[model samples]
Target: MKKLKLIAVLVLFPLGLNLVGVWELQRSTDDHAEYAAYQADLAEFRPELQAIADNSGSRPVMVDVGDGEKMEVKMALSRVTEMQDELDTLLPLTNVMAWVAKGTITLGLLAALVGGLGLLALNWAGRRAMHSRDQLLHSFTRVTKLLPYVLVGHVVVMGAAIAAIVAFEALGAWHAGRLSAGEMKFMFFGMVLVAGCLYSIWQMGTQLRVMLNMFQPTPMDVMGEAVTVEQAPVLWAYVKDLALTLGALPPDHIVLGMAAGFYVTSGDIALAPANTTLTGRTLHVPLAYLGILDEAETTAVIGHELGHFAGADTEFSMRFVPIYHGIERSLVVIGQTLVDSEWLQRATLHPAFMLGAYFMESFDHAVMHWSRVRELEADAAGAQLAGNLAAASALVRISAIDPMLQERLVAHITQATRPTSEHVPVSDLPTTVLREIAALPLTLPEEEMATQLPHPSDTHPSNGERVASLKVSIDDAVRSGTRPLDATQACAAMDRYFAQPDVLRARLTDDYLSHHVQQDAVLVETLRTHAGNVTGDVALHEGARLRGQILIGFSGLLAVAGLILLLAPVLFPGAAGRDPQPFFVGAGIALFIMLCMLPFGVRLFRRAHKTALLLTPDHFVFANLKAPLPIRDIADFNLQVGNVVMLTILLEDNAPLPELTSRSFFAPDVALNKKKRWLMLPMSKFCRDDKKLKLPELAELIGNYVNAGAARHLLQQRSEQSGELKAG
Candidate 1:
C-alpha cells in the first residue's frame, strides 16, 4: 500500500509541475500576441496620419473615435514610433518566458522519471524481504546500509536540478535585457548551492579524518591528563578478558574519564607502524558510572560497548555519519541563505524549491529512523556478550542513577561549604556522595518510565524499549549458558583504580560549582545578617511591589474602559452613531476584555498588597500567612537559582499551614508531605535587587534560623577569611 502511494506521488508530482509550466507559457504567448497587434495598429495609424498631413487639403484630420465620436487631431509620427519601440522591447521577454516554461516542463518530467525508478527499486527491495524471514532481515539490513547513499544521491540530483533551473532563468532574463544588477546579485542563491556542496564535501573529509584518527595510537600523556587507569589493574584486566571472551579484539587503552557513560572507538591497526596489530581501539569508562554501578553491572556496560566492536557495528554506523551531517548542513545552509537574502527570499519561494525542501526534510526523517534501528541492533549485540539480564539491569540502573547523582552532588557542595569542625576530605567526596545516592529510593515509576519512548529525532531507542529488547536477548543468552561477570568486584576494582581520587573529585566539584553558583561574597554576608534577624514580616522588594502595582493599574484601566464602553450607548442614545450593531459589538468585546482582566488585576493587587513576610523570634510567617513556622521545626534552607531566586525551606514535619491566596508568577512553592517537607519561596517577591540581597544571602539567612549551628559555622569561616584578607 505504501509502495503504491509512493508510485502515485512520483507519477503525479512531476506531471503537476509540467502543467504549471504549460499554463505560464500559454499566458505569456497570448500576452505577446496582444501587444504585437497593438503595435501593428499604431504603425498603420501613424502612416495614415502622415499621408493626411502630407496633403495640404487635409491639414487637420477628423478621425472617428470609439463610441462613434469624430475627433480632429494632428498625428505625430514620433509618438507612434515611441509606442512601437516600447512593445518591440517587451516582445523579447515573451520569448524568454516561453523558454523558461519549456525548461520547467523538461526538468519536471525528468524528475518524475527518476522518482519513479527510485520508488520501484524500493518496492523491489520490500518484496524481496517478504519472501522469507531470513531474506526479510537481509533486505531490511541492506536497506539501512543503502538508504544513506540513496538519500545523498537524491540530494545531489535535486540540488543540481535547482541550480540548473535558477541558472536558466538568469540566462533568460539577461538575454531579454531585463536583468538588473540587483537581480544578477540574487545569483548568490547559486553560490549558496555551491556552498552546500562544499559543506557536504567538508563533512566527508572530516569523517575520513576521524576514521583515520580512530586507528592511531592515543598518546599516554594526553590520556593521563583526563583519566586515571593505572590503579585499577584488576578492572582493566577483567575488561580486556571480557572483550576476548566476546570474540572481539581487546582495546589497547582503557581510561576512566568524567563523562557519564561508556563507549568504544575502533582504529585500524593496518594503518599503524609495524609494531602494532591491525585492530587498535580505546575504551572510555566514565568515573561517574564507576562509583554508581556494581562490578557485575559495570561488566555488563563494558560488554555492551564491546558488543559494538564485536559486530563491527561501530564502523558500519560511521559510514552514515557523514551523510546525515551533510543533509542537515545543506538544509540549514540553503534555508538560512534563502531566508537571509532579500532577492533570494522571493525567488526561492518557487514551487520547485519548496518541494525540494520538503523532500530533504523527509529524507532526514528516514535516515534518523534507521539510525535508531541501528542502536537497537547494537543493544541486542551487547546483550549477547553481557547476558540479557545484566545488560538490561545496567541500562535501567544508569538512567535512574544519573539525575539522582547530580541532585546529591549539589547538596554535598552546599553541605561542604559550611565551617564544620570535621572536614570532609575531598578524596572521599565522590565515594560518599555515590553511597548516599545509592541509599536513596530513587527508582522512576513504571508509568513515567514507559513514556521515555524514543522521539522521532532520537538516534537511540528509549530506555523502556532497550530494556525490553535486552529481556528477549536474555532468554537466548541464558539458554546458551552465558555466565555474567560479578558486578561487585568490578565496582571495587574501579574504586581502587583512581590514583588521585581527590583530583577527580575536585574537578567534578569545581565543574558543578561553576555552573550552579553565581553570587558575590557581599550578598552572602547580607543573607547571613538577615538569617540572624528575628524581625516582623519582611516586606516585598519595593521594585517588585511597584511592578505588581503597575500590572494592577493597567488591568484596572482595561476594566474601566470596558465598563464605560458597555454603558456608553445606554447613557447617551445615538452617541455611538446610527449603527447600534457596531456599538453593541464593540461593547461586547470590551466586556470580554474586562472579564479576562478583572481577575488578573485583583490577583496582582493582592500580590502587591500582601508582599511582607512576618517573622517572630521563634517562627517565620510567609506572605499573608495566619500562623508562623517554628524555627526549630525547619530542617534546612537552600536556593534553586535561575532568573528568579527560589528559597527552598525544608521542614522536619508536614504541618498544615494556611494557603496564601497570592501565588508567585515565577513558580509556585511546592509543599510536599511532612518529614520530607519542602516549600519554595520566590525571593523576587521580597528582594527586588539581587545586588543588595541575592538568592545566596536569602538561603544563608534562612539557613541560620533553620540550622543555626551550620549558619554560625559558616559565619565564623567567613569572618576568619575576611580577617586573613585584611591582614594580608
Candidate 2:
C-alpha cells in the first residue's frame, strides 16, 4: 500500500512539471495580434504588386515613381510578393503551436486526476481493512495481500505515462524540423526518471522476497548447534509438554544460541489441522537465557516464542514484513539516486522532496505502530500459555538480565581464572554463574524502565508496558493449572543430560573476551604494585583540587558582589532618593540567594579537602566516611567506569553501623540507618594527573585489603592472561 502511494507521488510529480511547461508555452503563444497585423500589411501590398506586375508586360519596364525619376516595376513587385509569402507561412504554425500546448495541458490534468483518485482509494481501503476485525486474521489479510498488486499496477501505469510524455515531446520536435536544446534536456530527464522508477521497483521486489524468505520455516541449519532430545530429554520434555498444554504444536528442532533471547520460525503456508506437524518448525533458545531463567520462567520465555506460531503472528508478519522493508529499501534507493545526481541533489532542498520525505516517515511510523500491536497480542497469547504472572516476570527479568549478564560473565571469568581458586571445570562454570546471578535482585528502576518505551521506529513496546498489559491479562482470568519442575532440579537435569557443556561454555567465554577484553600486562603489574603500597590517606587529585578552587572562587566573588550591591545606594548618595527601593530589593535577592547556597558550597569545599582513601592497619576509609570501615567486614569491591569512576563496596551479610545525620547543613534533617549497604566512592576526586589511578587499579587495591588471597590470585591470573595475549 505504501509502495503504491509512493508510485502515485512519482507519477504526479512529473505530471505537475509537464503541466507547468504547457502553461508557460500557452502564455508565450497566446498573443496572435502581431501575426494578424502582418497579414493585413501583406493584404494591402498584394493589389499594388499585381498592378505593378501587369504593367511590366513581359519586360523590365521603366516607370515614373513619386520619389524618383524612374524605377523598374518588376523589382518593386518582387519585394511585395516575398513579404506576403512569409506572413502566410508563419501565421498557421503559430496557431498550431498554441493548440498543441493546450492539448498537452489537458492530458496532464487527466493523468493527475486518475492517479490521485487511485491513491486515495487505496489509502481508504487500507484504513477500512485495518479497522475491520470481525474475521480476526481474515479481516486485513485480503487488504494487505492486495498491496503488492497495487504496487505492480502503479509501476506499470507510471512507466507508461513517462514514456508517453517523452514520446509526445520527441515527436513534436521532429514535426517542428529540429529539437531545441531545452527539449532535448527534458527528454533526457524523462528517461532518467523512467530508469530510476524501474530500478526502485526491482529493488523493492528483491527486498520483499528476502524478507518473506525469513518466514519460511525449516530446520535450524544456520543457527547454533542442535540440542536433541537425547542430550536434554528433561528440558525437551518440559518444552514439548508445555507446547501441547498451550495447544501449540511442539517444535521438531531446538537450537541453542549464545545470545540472550528465544524465537520461533515457521513456513509461510499454514498447514491444515489434520496435516499440521512440527516437521518444518525450528525453536532457537539462547543458552545464556536458559541458564539464568528458572524452570517456570524458562517455560514462559519459550511460550512467548511459541506464541508467535500459535497466535497466527507468523502469518501476519509475512504480509507486514514486505510492506515495511519495501518502504525502507525504496527510501534508500531514492536517497542514493538523488545524492548521486547533481541536479537531484539541488532538488532535494525543494519543497517536493521535503514533503515526500515526511510522507515516507509517517508511513513507516504507522507500520511500526501496528507491529508493536502484534507484539502485544503475542505477549497475551504467551501469558495464556505460561500463566500471566510468569510471563510478566519473565519479561521483566529478561529486560534486566540482558545488560547485566555480560558483566556478570566477565566478573565470573575474572574470578575463575584466579590462581587460588579451586578451578571449577569449564563445564560447571555456566551453572555456577547462573545460580549466583539468580540469587541477586533483578529489579529495574522505573526511570530506567521508561527508557524502553517504543520509539517511532521500534516494533516492541516498553518492558513496563508489557508487564502492565500482562497484569491486566492475569486479572482478567488468564491462568494455567500446570506447574513445571522446581528450578534447581530442572537445572540439574539439564546439566546431567547435556552434551559438550565444556565446549559450549568455552565458546561463550572466548566470544565475550575477544570482543570486550583488551590485555595489558604492564597495566596489571602497575595495579598490583599500587595495591601493595596503599598504607596511608590519599588526597584528592591536583586536577580535582583546581576545579574545586575555581568553583569556590566563583561563589566567593558572587558573595562579595552581593555585599557591594547592598551598600551601593549609600555610597552613591546622589541616586539614593530616586531608586533606593529598587536597588535595595535587587541587592537583597542576590544576597539571599548567595546565603541559601552557602551550605552546599561549604560541603563541596569539604569534599574537595577531606575526600581520600584512608588505608590503615585494620580499616579502609573512602570518600566522606565519618570513620574507617573494618577490612574484615568487606565482602567485595567492584568498579564501574563512566564519566566518573565509582567504587562499590558490598558488605558481608547485614553488618551494622552507627546512626548518622546529613553532613551538609542544607539537609541537616536527613538521617542514615545502621545496616550493611552498597557504598559508592567517587574515585575521580581522589585521582591525580601525574599518577592517575585507573578503576582496575583502585578495585585491585581495595580488593587486596578486603580479600588478600582472592585479590592476589586474581591479579596473578590477569597477569598471565595479559602475557599470553601479548605473546600471541
Candidate 3:
C-alpha cells in the first residue's frame, strides 16, 4: 500500500506541481533577492540622518580609547552604512516589483509553499517517471537498432531548420545591407520557442481533449441509437475485457479515439478495438486519417490502435504528459521572448538567424518523424493484439466492399457493398503469441522478444518499418525453430502490414532518390526505411560501402572546413594580413557547399552501392557504395524464389552488412520501371535462323553492376549457406 501510494503520488502529483512551478517561472524575470534586501535596508533607515554617538563606555571615554582610533571606527561604520544604502537604492534594478517593501513577508510565505509543494510532489513522482522513461527508452530500441540512420535523420532535420533560419536572416540582412552570424542562432531559436509554445499549447489541448474523450468510448448521444449496433455493449466493456485478457495487473483503462483510424491510450496500442468510449474521443475518421479507408475496416481500426496498446505505454503517457507540458510551456515562453526581444530585432538581420530558423524547422521535422514512428509502433501492437487472422480478416473485409458508398449510412453502406472477404482464419496465428495476457509471460517475458527500442534522442522510423519488423521477428522465429506460425498466417500478416499506405509511400527522400529507388534498390531502401520489403542479400560489403561514403562525405566535409577556418590564419598570416574574416568566410562557404550537396552526394553514394557487385573471372568483386567485399572474403548469402528472387547478403569478414535490404528487387531497369515491358520484338519469327543480340561477358557485367547481384557465384554461395545439397 505504501509503495502504491508512493508510485501514484510520484507519477501524478509532481506533474501538477510542476505545472504551477513552470507558471511561476513564467511570471517573474527580475531578481527577488536584491529587491528584498533593498526593501529591508530602506524599512527603517533615513538617508539624511546620522546615528547618535555613544561617548561614555563605563566612564572610560573616547580619550581612554585613543581619540583618533575611536573616530576611525565611527567613520568605518558610516562608510559601511553608505554602501548598504547604495545597494538598497539599486534594489529596484533587480526586480520589477518592490516585493520586499510591499508585503515581503506574505510573498515569502507563498513562495515557500509553492516550492515546498513542487519538491514534495517531485519526490513522490520521480521513481514512477524514471521507470516509465526506462520503458519508453525500451520502446525506442528500434531507433537505436538503426542508430546511424536515425542520427542522420536528426542531423538532416535539424540542419534543415537551421538552414531555413539562416536563409531568412540572410534575406533580412541583405535588405539591411549588413549581416551577423553570431547572434542569429539564438534569435532564431527564440522565435522557434514562441512558435513551439503555440504549437505546444495547441498540441497539448488536442492531447488533453483526446484523453478526455478516451473515457467516452461510444459516439456522442447526439447521434442517438444510430451511433452503434442496437443494444451493443459499450466500448468500455470491450476495453475491460481486453485489459483482462492482456493480463494487465490492476487493469489500466483502455480507450480509443482518433479522427479516422483507431488508436490506443497514450497513442500507443494495447488492444485491438477491444473496448472504447467514443463520447470524448473523435470518431467518424477525418479525411486526413481516413484517406479513403473504407468505413468497414473495423479490424484495421482495432489492429493499429492495439499495436500501440501492446507497447506497454500507460505509465509512459502518465509521465510524459508533464514533461510534454513543460516543454510546451518552455517553447511558448521562448517564442514570446524571441518575438519581444529588441536585441533580436537587430539580430534577426543576420544570415545566421535564417540558419537558426532552418535548425528549428529541422527540429520540427524530427518531431514529425518521431510522430510517424509512434504511429507505426501502434500499428504493430494493434496487429499483435488483433492476431494475424483477425487483422487480415479486417483488411480483407474492407477490401471486398464495393469501391463506392463506404461512408454512407452505416448498415446501408454495409448492405450495399460487402465483398466476399477472403482471409486466413484467426486460429492460424502462432498459438505461442498469446493475444492479451493479464501480464506478459514471466519466463519468456514480453521484453525479451521486444525489438530493442531507441534511446531518448531518436527520431522514429515509419509505421511500415515497425510492422515489417514484427513480420521479420515472426519470420526469424519460424526460421530458427518452429514457433507454430503457419505459412498462410505469416503470408497474411505480411500482406496486412503492407496494406497501410503509411507503409507504402515511395517518395523523393532525403537522398533525392525516388520512391522506386527506395522500393527497388536494396541500398536506397535501406537509407529510406519508411516502408517496403527488404528482399535482397544482406551484402555487408555493399552496405558498408554506402554507409562509408555517406558518413565520410557528410562528416568529413564539415570537419575539414571547420579545421581550415581555424588554421588558415595561423598558417598563412602573411597572406591573410591578420584578417580572420576572409578565412572564416571561406570556411563558411565550404560548409555551405557541402550541406547543399548532402542529398545529391547521398544518392550517388547509394547508386554506387548497387553498382559495386562484379563477377570477375578470378572471383566475384563485391564492391558496393560503402566498399568492395570480394567473393574471397564472402562467407555466405541466401536466395529465395518468388515473383522476384531475394537474397540475403552476408560477410565472412567480421564486418556485418547493413540490415536495410534483406531481399532483392532484382529486375531490368525497363522491366522494373513498367509492369509489362519486355526485351524483344514479336516472337513469331524462327529463333534458330534469326540473328539476335546477345549479352557478352562485358555486357553482363555492366548489367549486373548496374544493380544488385544475381550472378552464378552469388547464388552458389547462397545455396551452400542453406546446406541445400551444394550444387555440382
Worst 10 residues of 2 by lDDT: 476-485
- Residue ranges of candidate 2 with Cα displaced over 4 Å: 1-48, 58-96, 118-126, 132-241, 249-255, 265-282, 311-314, 321-377, 406-441, 447-458, 461-465, 468-499, 504-728
What is the TM-score of each predicted model, taking all chains together? 0.44, 0.47, 0.23
For candidate 1, lDDT tens digit of each residue in 45-83?
Answer: 887866765673755666663488665545355556666
Candidate 3 overall Cα lDDT vs. reference? 0.34
Question: How displaced is residue 620 in candidate 1, in Å?
Answer: 25
Q: What lDDT would candidate 2 get against the real structure?
A: 0.54
- Tell me the tens digit of each residue's lDDT in model 3 across 1-728: 53344323323333343343333333323444544655565444423223323443333322112354454434544654665665554443333223212222232333334333433433333332233345333423222233223222222223233333333322222211123574565556655764653453344333333222221212211111112322223343444454454443212332211112232223222222233333222222111212223222333454454333344543443333223323333344444545665553222222122222222332343344444555555545445555543333333222222121123222222221221233111221111121111012212222223322221222444322443545544333222221222433333332232223222221101111222233335533442342121233322112233443765577576769767786888887877785799788878877777766665445434443343233442234332123333443444443444533333344444543422213223211111111221111111111111232132422333234323333344444533543432221
Instruction: State the RMSD for candidate 1.
Output: 14.3
Top candidate, metric TM-score = 2
